[model samples]
Target: MMLYPSIMKLMEKTGSRYSLVIATAKRAREIEAAAQETKNVDGARSISKAATEIADGTVVVFDADDADSADEVFED
Candidate 1:
């Protein structure tokens, strides 16, 4: 996804770690499943009190639509 490169660049520039949060109206399982399909995604966690944890200094990457050829960003 176009956002991936920017997100990665931000991470590199800030020297910070990151996480992904899926906020679609879809079921949590579906969101997790979609994230599971992504490499270097780390993993998906509930967005409860973890919201603050997720909202830390790290940058949040968003994909307006389903992720497709965007996976190339994580490639060597």
Candidate 2:
């Protein structure tokens, strides 16, 4: 239930609440892992960092049904 307004925008982009949750949770876990492995991480909490990443378009979320679409949305 990370209900930041900015994060709501990301939810709209993903077109599914479940997808947004998955993305945010995954990013939060990464942030936590990074904190464990290093210091000087700018002092942002993992949940906040996750929301900011979504709001800033630094991360993209895709629905489970959209596997093919994911490739296009996330081109290398």
Candidate 3:
């Protein structure tokens, strides 16, 4: 079966399988929380939506090691 936003493509952005998983899960949680507050459900799975965002470059993984400071760990 074909996977939209294939894992390899996501790894290209995240640099590793582990990083890709971390980034995807974090974004998915954010999407879920927002949906809860807004009382909105677009009928799309949170995980898939998050993956799409990463694939489209709308979301990114900010590695703490690559940051200039501790506070710069995560970015929008």
Question: Which prediction has the highest lDDT against the true structure?
Answer: 3
lDDT string for model 3 (10-35, tens) is 88888988888888999999999999
lDDT of each: 0.40, 0.78, 0.86
In candidate 3, which residue pairs get closer than 3 Å at backbone N, Cα or C atoms, i.e. clash? none
Candidate 2 local lDDT, residue 51:
74
RMSD (CA, Å), each prediction: 11.9, 2.7, 3.0
State the lDDT of candidate 2 residue by residue for 2-62, as single tens digits.
5564655876777777777788889999999988898647876897888788777787766
Q: What is the lDDT for 2 in model 2?
A: 50
- How do these models rank on TM-score, best leading? 3, 2, 1
lDDT score of model 3?
0.86
Local error of candidate 2 at residue 13 (angstroms): 2.2
Q: lDDT tens string, model 1, 21-69?
A: 3431233454456667874355445332233323353333445442553
Error of 3 at 60 (Å): 1.4
After superposition, candidate 3 runs with Cα above 4 Å error: 69-76
Clash count in backbone of candidate 2: 0
For model 3, how many clashes? 0
Candidate 1 — worst ten consecutive residues by lDDT sum? 18-27
Q: In each prediction, how many residue pairs overlap at the backbone (N, C-alpha, C within less than 3 A)?
A: 1, 0, 0
